[model samples]
Target: MFCVSENLYLRDVKLSDSSIVAKWKNDPLIRELSIGLDTKITNENQESDIKKSIESKQPYYIISLKDSDRPIGYIRLNWMDNSERFGWLRFGLGEERGKGYSKEALSSFLQKVFSNDTHRIDAEVYAFNKISLNLLKSLGFIHEGTRRNAYYTKGSFFDVYTLGLLKGEFNYIKRDDK
Candidate 1:
C-alpha cells in the first residue's frame, strides 16, 4: 500500500486486483465519467498492465477508506514531459463518487505530489464533468484554460479544461494536524 492521506494508504493495482479493477471500471456509475479505455478487462490485460505499472518510476496508488480498508478508487501520478519536474493525475472511484472522498483523495494526492519537490501538478478534465471540475476547484486547482475539442470519444470531440496547482499553494495545509 502507498500513503495518500497522512494516515491513509493506497495499494498498487495487481493481477490479483483484476476482479476489483474490472468491477470498478464496469460499474456504470463510475465508468461513465472516468473511463478512458474501451477494451475488455481480463486477467491477461491486468497482468500485462501490471507489468507496465511496475516498470514506471512514477507514483500510482489505489484509494481505500481509512476505516474499512476497502479499495474504493484509484489515482495515477505521471509526467507530461520528461525534462521538466511536472506531471498530471487521473483518478477514479468505484462507489465513493459522491461521498466527499474525491476531495479528500485529491487533497492527499496533491500533498504527495508536492512532497516530492516537484514544481507543478496538472489535470485535464472533460468540460461536461462538473463533479470533477468542482472537486478540483474545491482543492485549489486554478482553471488555467481550455483545450478546444481536444478529446474525441463516444461520438464527437469534447472540450477539456486544464487546471493546475503549484507546490507553493499547498504550504498552508495543516497536513500533520489533519
Candidate 2:
C-alpha cells in the first residue's frame, strides 16, 4: 500500500527496513509509549516479522518524507475480525517525533483505508502518552473508554485509553496535487 500527503508518504514495509525498525523498536522512549511487549527485538527477529507480515498481506507501511524519501516511522492496521473492516492502529516514529509528520502520514493513510471500504479504526494509547491521545482526538477519534491499569511498564501500571473513529466521522479532504 502507498499513500501520499503534502509532506510525507507511506509505502509497504520491506525487508531492508528491518535494521532501522529494530532500532525504533528498541528505543527506550518508544517502548515506554507503545502497548506491545517491552522486550528488545533483534534485527533478525524484526526481519522475520516483517517477512511474515508481508506474506500475510497486512497493512504495514513505512512513513517517509517525500523530499528525501527518508523513513522516519511506521504505521500498520491489524484487523480485528474476519470482515476486514475494523482495524487496530499501531504506529511509532524514530527521531522525527515533533515535526507534524505523523498527522500528515496518518491523515493520508486513514483517507486511503476509509476509501477502500474500511468501516472503522481503533487505537489504544497508554494514558501517559498524551501526545498520541491528543493526536488521535484531533483526527476525529472519540474516546471510547479506559482500561484501568492495563499496561505494566517501567515498574508501574498505566491506564490505557481506547479511541475509535468511524469512516463517517473522518473529516479529511484529499487534495489532488499531493
lDDT per residue for candidate 1 within 97-143, as digits (tens), equals 66666666777767766777678888888888898887777677889
Most accurate candidate by TM-score: 2
Note the Cα lDDT for every prediction shown: 0.72, 0.88
Candidate 1 residue-wise lDDT at 1: 55
Model 2 lDDT, full chain set: 0.88
- Model 2 collision count: 0
lDDT of 2 at 31: 82
Candidate 2 C-alpha error for residue 76, in Å: 0.5
Task: Please give the lDDT score at residue 55 for candidate 2.
Answer: 89
- Tens-digit lDDT string for candidate 2 (75-127): 98888877789999999999998878787888899999999879999999999
Q: Which stretches of candidate 1 lie over 4 Å from their true place?
A: 4-8, 36-40, 81-84, 153-156, 171-178
